[model samples]
Target chain A: MSLEVNGHKTYAYTGNHAFDACLPTVIFIHGAANDHSVWALQSRYFAYHGHNVLAVDLPGHGKSAGDALNDVATFADWVKALMDAVGIEQAAIVGHSMGSLIGLETAARYPAIVTRLALVGTAIPMPVTDALLETSAANDHAAYEMINVFAHSPRAQIGGNRLPGAWMMGNSMRLMERSANGVLHADFTACNSYRGGLDAAKKTKCPVLLILGQRDLMTPPRAAKEAAASFSNARTVMLDGTGHSLMSEQPDAVLDALIDFLRPKNVTAA
Target chain B: MPAPKTYQLDTLSLHAGQQPDSEFGARAQPIYFTTSYVFPDTDHAASLFNMERAGHVYSRISNPTNAALEERIAALEGGVGAIATASGQAALHLAIVTLMNAGSHIVASGSLYGGSHNLLAYTLPRFGIETTFVKPRDVDAFRAAIRPETRLLFGETLGNPGLDVLDIPRVSEVAHEAGLPLLVDSTFTTPYLMRPFDLGADLIFHSATKFLGGHGVAIGGLLVDGGKFDWDKSGNFPTLSEPYEGFHGMVFTEESTTAAFLLRARREGIRDFGACMSPINAFQIMQGMETLGPRMQRHMDNTRAVVAFLDKHDAVEQVVYPELPSHPDHELARKLLPNGCGAVFSFELKGGRSAGRKFIESLKVFSHLANVGDAKSLVIHPATTTHYRMDDAALRAAGITEGTVRLSIGIESAEDLLEDLSRALRASQKA
Candidate 1:
């Protein structure tokens, strides 16, 4: 299933039509340097189980064409507009890395529109080294290597060991390389400067899920731990042997956590 | 060490759980790094095992260093007793399991930490336990959700990332009406902003890894028994009133009325689960706790300044902070947290996800990590990060949108933090 969201033709893997109608929709937001295809597993798996899954290409990332952003709030506005466009009055947002930050801001800004939030491989106070930024700017090779080094597990890194994983990495690297440097820099800068959500985290009226990979060097589990601490209603999950790209590296674990969080229970059942 | 009748948090944070070293007279709490404690005699050891006495029998059950942390936190939370665990998750699990059985149920606020939501929504059901989730401030919803089998009512004092204030008293009333205890995860608000016990909570829990250990050095959790719940009155709590084969038929409520839950949690829950906190982590958390009051004050101040800056920014569509009059819960926040809310909030970008990403890229001072409550500022996009797992409907129910950026304000100079945010917002708009 597909529809126009924020002027972009968005695609979604509509889970069981009957289930999708009854169950809440889930929007998958990709991380920096990646496209909607990054959520192939999640979209399909979730859709199959009974969810309305929408995974769109952020403007200028994939099929969506628009000028990149320079301000974090602009992107947040775009998300709000997109939600409006799709007639999705409310949703449970699942974001990874850069997407996680966006999810945080979205829930914080439009508290009425978000039902629940799952921040995967996210952190506040993201630590980005100068070398990483310089390498990403210098060439595609450095950029790919840096992202891979920070995102993949040692086992996944072994040549020819995980062909699909490697292919995904290569494809994501290509997309990121194609993205404008100004946009990338802006994104990093916004991340570096962001300081609004902690208090929001403490007071979020909604349920929040903080997921981190134990081996994630980019945003280690420690960062998730810290964020989880401020959330009285929050819970933290540290996935063993997974890095920042938990969705790609261990989608099953991520899915398990999400399923656990979203399933209706005696308490949550309306 | 003899327990004082009562002490200030500042003093108790340093000395409540420690004694001058018997061998060295060390003024600081020495890490009894060893796993096992020597028994004075066989009868003493047997008595400990038989529940006739209270002492550390094993590391998994208790340790001197961890015990000190448990005591300190108990004192800080104004609880009769406490139990330390390996991690915050473990602490939550222990708390839930200690109170509930296979056929029991829980009434929880919908606004919760994701992990806790999962545990309540999915995992607990696997064990035949059930949960009912309601909006934090929906006192009526809580009352409506409670069942005859509901064993407890749960909520966080301050919700994570989005900063939704919990209406503790109203929910407490609902729980008490159902003859159930209210368990509050006070990790976010800490004791500095609000004390759950004073607000009517029967139990308080903390993920000591964050603000309590402000430096981000340790991972530990504590469960403090308010010593207020009447287990005997509520027949739902069998673990507290019933005899235990594990502890020679001793009933927790009768043996330790003021700390029945804590005693049972320590003796049976942590003991059986084997998720005791590490002595080293406990010691590190203690160090952080020593400065908690001061750190929290700075965090609150920095957060207020940041909120002011964001509220004034043109690109920001909405700023969700309880302190802001614009927030729907502003009045409730004032009544509950007069000292000011903790240091996390969210805002929407004009351009949505792309602009949100670009803004993150443009920042120079703030680090883009997934963690919060550090001495440093942090940022992330929720649409693309934390709430991704939730389907759109759930996201909407939870209030997540694509362009939203969640910020964890730090203890930095508010001016510098505002400048960095300004630059990032400008850069994102331009991009």
Candidate 2:
């Protein structure tokens, strides 16, 4: 569904189900160079299983219309504005990679509105290598190739997607290719330049679930342990043999963990 | 950061899709031969049906064994996903139906396999779809043939026996300019020889019954989605962008950023068409495909030898392989098919139909049959066999003659294949 957020047209996938104001809401945020479709299976599950799902394509990323935000702080503000636009009072925020920082900043800034937080494939003070930034800045195809290689594990680099017939690596590559030329660079800049993650974790008061990939090269699991200490209330679910693309490589495992953590206990007060 | 070290084609062929069974530790891809799977409970069943989860409910929709083949093919083709079908024709049918419905039109190449010609020219039109056929080398002719109703522009990567190499980049330019997708038949030139998607084709299908299967034992096809075409942006395909009434009012493009085409192709076309590949056949094809790299190298080597013998022979009028400088699209073939123009090609005998019969009958080492891409060498007269249904204009456009004899050089000994063709050519001239 298309909604208005800060006057820019925003697209959110509701899993083909309409959002009811009475139900608790779950808003899914995707990582760099991706849209709401990354959460296709998970967001759809939540919508069907009694949550008002709003899997948004962040501004200038996917179907959403606007210029790409320059920093994580702006992205956090955009997420809060999106919820306000949709009349979603308080909701559980689920974010992956770059979006995780946005969720952390949002939770810290607006503790009254954030009921719970689930950080997927996240890290504190996420860093981008100089080589990746150069390639992405030039809008070269090699940057997409580099990220796709590192994002998937050796096991995932091969196959065995629970989703029949889909190739996870190829799909990830194509999704990055689909984004506009400068969107990826802007996203990487947001992640690399952000220093508010640990401070945000300290201020955040909501129950937190940190889902980390055991073999993730992009954000090492060691970072998640450091993040857990900063959060007042947080637990971790480590997916074995998975990579940075945990949502796609270990989709069922990720969803199962989400189902347990964000069970009825964490349902937002609508 | 370290440089990316993704697996190459040979490695992908051997190990791209299959994972050892967690239960019994079966290293080989196990065939899930059953028709249905048991769900853990009712919610799980509903979730599977609703596309809220990713598990197979029925064989026609998907099977673990077939998915191994699909994923492997997708990996090989650099596609987001693929669907395995009963035949090459079924894969072609699945692609067309998924994109458009009644009153749709296609601008296709005149130099197509007869089976493809039959579908686009005859059967599809019966259901209110129409096609305009143009020469594959005539890129402008493709653009000229497109009407307001046209949704697809299609051609073979290497046009059947004629070997008229389709200029994928140029033709795809025309399709993209008109907000359409270019679908190509890569049956003759498999991914081993040419990847159509990398060359700008949006969709590709292979007659796995031939080269991919190699042994001529199993009949199957693979339809791959390159996942590059923007169906949502095109506004030409409401079937993908709009809420599909056929399946829960779900917007397919909203489901997957890149794989919307494959999603709709599998969900609606494969489910309703009922032209699904069996797990056993999928397994058989995978067996041949595992050795695809080495076999293709040998297939190309044997072909070069056969082409050389036939090129200077007294009884041979002309050879239609693209490697020959005399062929019309030799330059284009060199540009596109860097590996080789595949193993299938046709040569005209000095005598006409009688000579075709004589040569076919005289061949000892080569099997006189309609199929190509077998482990054993095979021969056929396209005018009477595989392309029998095409009329004079279609036949001429496809570069076929009464004297034309097509050969699918296999991985067999080149010495034997050369002797067999030389003896057959001498016998053919007697007619």
Candidate 3:
């Protein structure tokens, strides 16, 4: 779906369905140098099964026009602007990696607008390695190469992708490759500069879900404990043999966990 | 600077898409012979059919065995995804129909496999889709042939019979300039010789019946999506950028950033056209594909030997192999086909069609067959068979003579192949 935010054209995948405000809303945010299509399966399921899905491509990343935001706060504000533009008073926020940080910040500062939050492949203080930062800052293809190799587990590198025909490694790499020059650098800089993840987790008043991958090298599950502890009411689900690109590597598990969390019959919202 | 880490081609060949059978602990890939899959419940069935989930609904849409081979080929070709079809022609048809409709046009190489030529020149026009043929070497002709209705630019990695190297990088640039995607037939060269995607081609298809299934036991085709083209930005591909009513109003490009072409081809083309690869054929193809790297290397080695032998023979009028310095595209072939040109080549004899018949009848070891890329070396007189209907003028236009003989050198003993060819050539001259 196309919408205007801050007078700039913004592109969001509305699960191929016209957005209906009467239904419960779910906004899916992607990680660094990525776009709305990253949540192709996840967002579609939500849209079909009783929710209005908005998988947004952050400004300047995909079809969205305007300069890319430099930090988590600005991205959160843009998401707010997007929601406001689309008349979504409140919605669930589900994000991955850098997007997870944006979701955390949005829920922390704009709690009224966020109903629930789900973070996938997140770290408390998301730090960019010096090599990666320098490489991306130079707008070098090698930066994407490093991330592609590091993002997946050893098994994913060899390939047993559940989704037919799609090669996980190639698919993930191609998405990141679509980012324009210096856009990837801005995304990494944003992730590296963020300091409010733990604070955001603590400040969040709504129910939270942490979806970590066991073999995710980008944001290893072992490092998620500090942030996970900060949440007053958060559930953790670690997927085995999956990497940072868990949504693509294992679509069903990610969707099932997300669906079950969003419409819990047993566990009420905190 | 660290290099991008990826599995070697040989490694991917043996193990890219298949895992050990979780049910029976079988190491080999098990064929999912069933035509349809049982859904868990109503919701799961709805989700699968509605494109909300990814799994096999029917063998026509996808099959486990076919998908394994598809994934492996996509990996080897550096593509996002691929679709396996009943034959190479089916794969090409699926690709063309998914991107375009009636009244669309294509700019393609004039020197193509006879079957491909038939499809573009004769059959597609019947459906209101037209194609303008351009010389593979003439990049300018490719650009000039593009009309407003042109949706695609296509060529073979190695032009049939002549081994005319289709300058992919140059042709793809021209295609991109015109907002079209370059589709190349990688049947002859395969990924072992070159990856078209790496050279700017947006799409690639293969006759897996050829070198991919090196033993030539089964027939199948693979169409791979390079996943780099921006269909929305291109402003020409409404089939992808706009909502497709045929498949639940799915805008394919919005569904997957990298695999929009693949999604449409599988969902709409394969589902409706019903030209899908059989699991049994997929199994046979995979069994041969497992040793692709080594088999291709041997094929190249043996081909080099046969080309060398034919070049110096007394009965030969001329030999056409890209690696030979005498060939027109030798330098380009050296640059583009660093691994090798291909295993197949054509040579003219001193005598006419009668000589070709005598030569084939005299061969003791080599088989006289219509197919190429077999374990056994095969020969065919193109003038009498493949290009039979073409007049003498048209025959010469395609670089075929009355005595032109096409040879598909195989992984046999180089010495024995030479002896057989030596006898055939001598017999041809005597006739």
Candidate 4:
């Protein structure tokens, strides 16, 4: 369940390939600092329950190649091209944090291509603090810590701070070091500059889902709620004790929500 | 100097919602951080609770800081009154719930923020209410979808991520014909670009977390009542017209004429839901609102430059910005958001998803975050992100492809933004 998208080989993991051919596809876009591996649990869970799962390493973050882009539009263009390359005419997009914003751009620009959207741990036009940008530029350690603070639940934070998770963070940081500073800066800059709201959410003719970690400090649940308000067909689900890394923190819950969303309705038998 | 009769947006942004504090002569609206307001007497408390007086009762219901924000937004939106909520979703939920009951129905635009889409598509159904989604531009579709049980029509003034401009007037007409009120979520356009109430909407809602709270320091929502709809005539909104057991058996319509809907919303809806805006968040949003007009201008200018650059990019398969003639909704954008469509647009790469990923990875200026309406630039791929909940068929139906990337242009220097995009495009092609 994979294809070469835009000359770069892309991988898709469909847990259940025998589902109805007419079933919708669920595409997973990981965050700025992570790769498609972050969605391993999600892909398997959804695929097991009759879904066509597509998890991609946003170029430079995972198995994908190259460096980060400078502006937001180029990233969006690249995604559009990838969609074209995969021969996936369209699908439901779910993005976390940075991925969520990218999903917004894709749905907005290619309304004809995005049937539904779920923005997790992200807001329309994310707010950036100077401290955050400074940390990303000067102190990778601080940046990682800040990101973890924002992404993990308070309980996870306390737990991760103690033993195995702390070691895991160390490993993650080493991997994140390979990510170019340019990409991190551009991602934050794009988030800082993005201007999305109710008006923008209104134009698309599709349903939308928003998932937020109640304890997320990075892109707080409140912001997700605000962004969700703009859509006529939108719902907000705040996972208690969860943070920005909702897929990792509550993978089963996220999968269940997606499964429910992807389940075809009677459609009034039209 | 005295304030000009008609101040520009910049001037309005600074002074629109404020007056000198009567006791301290404070220039800025001071934050009244207290949770409860003291009453003059038992009679005064009764009067306030009875809707015969105008003042704060509890911070959870309303507060001085939150009230200042409500007034500021109401003045900016030219609405009769406003109620600030804990978050934008609460505002939307309260708006819909205020007008319709469990058995009622709604006709909504299909293009929507993921959270909102889920709320209408899934959660509301659990409450015994159902929604029929239609294209925002298809007035006929909306009209055709309306059922006898449909009590309200809803659409975003501009769609999320899609950046599609809604035909507010046309849709409003359709709703009015059905004796229904049109609720427009004006989060993106704000009062600066397009005022939904002025454009014939019965109500407006905003997720103050974005542009309104430009700094991203706080999260809040506001609901504005246009006082344009005649609930008595509609007969569909009994909550506003009928007696309520929650508020000492007071009838909202009889107690408050212009602010009946808002009053009922605060006294009953929010009280029961407990989705109250924190005074601290309200204060932070107020600070953001003070700079909204200027920030929006920069966002628009930057967006135009970015759109132009993307339109000419060699790797770009297409650019979908309403301001560009190439956009399918360009004409409609002109009619609606003539001042300028707010900053946010999308483009597709010629190289497909891999190229899209490479380009995203190649960025130097734009952050690869998933949020929009920031002071900085952002980029994302939709097939892998926001719309991933939909299966392939639904994705095709919604128009999302693997190579599609969504961009939220920031207020960075246009040259910087352009250079970043150019480099990424080149990198994407090479990759």
Candidate 5:
């Protein structure tokens, strides 16, 4: 479904269902150089199992139209505007990598609107290496190669995807390579420049869940210390043998963690 | 300053998708002949069935042995992923059906394998898909043939029978210009001679029964996706870019940006068509791939020697080997196929139909059969064997004649192959 958010066209996958504002809302945000498709299994499962799923392609990514935001704050604001446009009063926001940071900022800035927050493969003060930032700025293909190799674990280098015949490493490389010319550089810059994670974590009152990949080199589990501590009610779950590309590497584990956290028995249907 | 490069082609062929078998510590891949795997519990079963995890549940959908072959081939071809099928024709069918609907059209080179031609001309149209055949050498003809409904532009790496080298760079540019993908049949050249993705082809398929399976013990096909084509940008492939209702509204392009075509091909094509390859066949193909590097080199070496001898012989009317200056695609072959023009080529006998048969009967070492890419040298008279259904006029249009004899050079001693061909040529003249 396409919606007008902040005067730009934003594309969100509605879980193969027409968008209906009546159900409980869950929004999926993707990492840098990625779109809504990264949430393929997770979002579709939720949509089919009684949830209003909105896997949004951030502005200037995937099918959405606009210049990529230069900082996390603008991305957070766009999510809020998208909710207002779609007529959803409250939602559980889930994000990964750069998206996790967006979820952090959104929950902080608009605490009343964000009922629950789940961050996967996340870290506070997400730092970009000078080498990666510089190469990405130059738009070198090597940057893609480096990230593709590092994002995947040794097991992911071979062939095993939820769908048969899908190569995970190759698929990730191609997705990163497809990012609009200046998009990667902008995304990394935004992550590097943002200094609000500690502040956002303190302001966020909603129940938060942090899903960390034990082998994630991009945003190591150790790096999420500050954000985890600041949250009033935050729980961190660490998964072994998975990397930054946790969604594809250990999909079932990640989904199970999220599903368990998001759907609590105490919370009755609205 | 740069990071060290990963494995090369030789190393990738052996190690790309393989890990030491954990249970028995077997070094080589073991064929998992079982049909279904036991899930750990209810949730585990649900996750795998719901596409939340990556593991083999059913042999028909995926098997460990077949996945190893798929990944190894993808690594060799510089592609994102590959699907193993029952045969080359099945691979082609999966690729076409995944991207197109009933009203879709295709622009293909006229020079194609007889089976491929039959599929495009007669079979696919029966299902409502149409194809326009163009001469491989005519670049403008390809451009002019494109209609708004055209979904793909296709040709062979080395055009079958006539080794017309498809100018991949040029044709792929044309395809991208029209927001379409270029699909090539790389059966003849294999990845050793050419990596179609590197040359601009978006998707490639091979008749593994040939070069990839040098022993010719198994019949299988491999369809590889380069994962470079932008299906969403084209806006023409709804089967990929848009939500598909068949699989609970899964939008393939959203599933994996580069691998969407392959995702649908496996989930929908293999599921509905039921033309999956056997695990044993996949294991055999994997064995063939282990020796692909050395075997292809030997096959090319023998071909050059045989082509040189046939060019100088008195009984030969025309030699259609692309490396020779006399052939039309000689220069293109030099530019595109730097390794070699491939092991298979056709040569004409000065005398007519009876001479062709006499030549085949005269050969002792070369097996007269309907298949190629065998360990033993093989020969076939296309006018009588592959293209017998076509009338004389149709055969002429397809660049075949009664005197044309197709030879698939094997990895044998060059001297032996040359002597055998020499005897056949002399016998043909006398007949």
Candidate 6:
């Protein structure tokens, strides 16, 4: 469904169902060079089961209309505005990689509105290499290829997608290729330049779950230490043989962890 | 900061999509022949149906063996995703139906396979989809034929029988200018000779029964999505962009940035059309693909020797092969098909239709049949067999004559193939 977030039209996949504000909400945010489609399986599952799901296309990234935001804080603000536009009082925010940072910031800034947070393939101070930054700035196709290769594990390149016949590596490359010219450069820069991870971690009040991919080179599991230590009620799960694309590479495991962590203690599926 | 060593085509061909069986540790790809997978509980069933997970539910939608073929072919073609269908005709039909509805039009090349020609000219029109057949060589003619309802531009990589190579880059330019995707049948050339995606084509289909299957034991087709075309930007493909009510109000383009076509093709087209490939067939094709690269090289080597022998033969009036200077698309083929212009090409016999039959009867090695891309050499007289449905003008347009005898060179010894063709030509002269 399309919403008027911050006076610009925002596109969110409603998990293939009509939006219902009556139910508890779950918003799935994708990483850089991607949109709601990255969370295709998870979001659809959540919406169909019990929750109201909103897998969004960030500004200028996909179906949404607007310029790409220059920093992580602005992206967080947009997420809050999206909730308001959709009449969602609070949502359990689930984010991946770059979206993980946005989820952190949103939890920090909007403590009352965020009931819980789940971060997948995340780290404090997510850093981009100088070479990747330079190549991305030049809008070179090599930058896309380099990241795609790095993002996926060697096993993933051989192809066993949970979704049969879906080539994970090839789809990742094409999604990156589909992004607007400055989106990747800006996204990588935002990840590189942001110095607010410690501050956001300190201010965050919601229960947090950190899901790390064991073989993730982009944001190594060890890199989650500082952020994990900051959260008073944080629980961490490390998946075996998984990569940065944890949602696709280990979809069932990721879903199991997220669903177990997010579902209310007393409530069961009716 | 070291880059990982990526596997090459041959290694990927053998191992890309297949994993050792987790249950039995079977080394080769284990064909899962079951009709449906069991769900653990109701929620699991609901989740699987809702696209919450990626595992298969029913064989008609997807099977483990078929998924392996789909991934292997996608890897070989340099495409984002693919779907295996009942046959080459099913693949073509799936690709078209996924993009078009009643009243949609297509601008297609005149030099197409006979079955494809029949589908576009007679079959599809019965359902309100119209097609304008343009000469594959005329780039401008493709652009000129587009109507407001035109959904795609299509051609074969190497034109059937004639061996006229379609200029993918140029035709794709015209298609892109009008915001349409170029869909090509890459059956003749395969990825070994040319990857149409790299050359600017957006979608490709192959008769796996031919080259990819190599042994001609399986009848299956594969449709690959390059994921290059922007359906949202095109504003020409609402079937992809708009919310489809049939499948839970899913706006396919919004579901996956690169894979909307395959998603819809599998979910709706395959589900409703019932033109799904069998897991056994997929397994057979997977075996053929393991040796595709090396087999293609041998096919090319033997094809060159056969073309050469046929060119200078007394009873052969014209040897139509792109590698030959006299062929119209020779230069284009040299540019696009550097590996060779594929194994299949036609030659006109000096003794009309009667001689064509005699040559077929005279050949000891080459089997007389209607199919190409078999490991064993094959021959077909198109005027009476493949192109029998077409009238004289239609035959002329496809570059077929009463004496046109098509040869599909095999990976056999070049000396043997040359000897076989020479003896056949000598017999045709006497007839």
Candidate 6 structure quality by residue, lDDT tens digits, A1-270: 887888888899886677776788888888988888888888877887778989998888878888878699999999999998888778889999989999999998888888888999998889999878988898888788778877887778798677889888888888888888989998888788878987898888888899998889899998989889988778999998888999889989989988887786622221
Q: Please give the range of 10 consecutive residues that has the lowest summed lDDT in model 1 chain B.
A: B1-10
Q: What is the DockQ for all candidates, taken in turn?
A: 0.01, 0.76, 0.75, 0.01, 0.40, 0.62
**Residue A229 CA error for candidate 4 (Å)?**
59
Position B235, candidate 4: lDDT: 78
A143-200 in candidate 3: lDDT tens per residue? 9999998898888887767788889888988999999898989999999999988888
lDDT of 5 by residue, B1-431 (tens): 26426567787777767777879989898888889999999877876776766778888878888888898898889888999999999999999999999999999999899799999999999999999999988988889999999999999998877889999999999999999999999999999999999989999999998999899899999999999998888998999977788887788887676788988998899889978899999999989898888999999999999999988889988899989999888898899999998999999888888898899999999999998887679999987777779888888887899899999999989999999988988898898
lDDT of 4 by residue, A1-270 (tens): 445656665544343253344666677887766656456545655554445667666765544656655445566666788777766677778888888878777787777778788788876667777877777666355666566555666444322111100112222333454465666766677677777544457665578888888888788777766567777778877788787777656655776576666665611110
TM-score of chain A of 2: 0.98
The numbered model that scores best in DockQ is: 2
Tens digits of per-residue lDDT, candidate 1, B213-282, equal 8787788888877766778777878888877778756566544334567767877798788888888998
What C-alpha lDDT do the candidate models reach, one value each? Answer: 0.73, 0.91, 0.90, 0.72, 0.87, 0.88
TM-score of model 3's chain A: 0.97
TM-score of 6: 0.96
Using lDDT, give the best candidate's number: 2
Model 6: DockQ vs. true structure:
0.62
Q: Which stretches of model 5 miss by more than 4 angstroms?
A: A19-23, A225-232, A266-270, B1-4, B39-50, B241-243, B387-395, B426-430
Lowest lDDT 10-mer window, candidate 6 chain A? Answer: A261-270
Specify the poorest-scoring 10-residue window by lDDT in model 4 chain A: A158-167
- Candidate 4 accuracy as TM-score: 0.60
Off by over 4 Å in 4: A1-270, B1-8, B388-392
Kindly list the per-residue Cα lDDT of model 1 for residues A104-151, writing each as its tens digit. Answer: 888778888778888888887565667655555454346555676567
How would you encode candidate 6's per-residue C-alpha lDDT over B1-431 as one tens digit per residue?
Answer: 33445667788789878788889999889989999999999888877876778788999999999998999888888889899999999999999999999999999998888799999999999999999999899999999999999999999998866777899999999999999999999999888888899999999999999999999899999999998899989998888988888888888887888989998998899989989999999999999999989999999999888888888887888898989999988888889988898999888899887888888999999999989999999999887787788887877866788899888999888898888888888888888
Docking class of 3: medium
Q: Candidate 3: misplaced stretches above 4 Å?
A: A264-270, B388-391
Share of reference contacts kept by candidate 1: 0.00
* Model 2 chain B poorest 10 in a row by lDDT: B390-399
Over the true interface, candidate 5 deviates by an RMSD, in Å, of 2.5
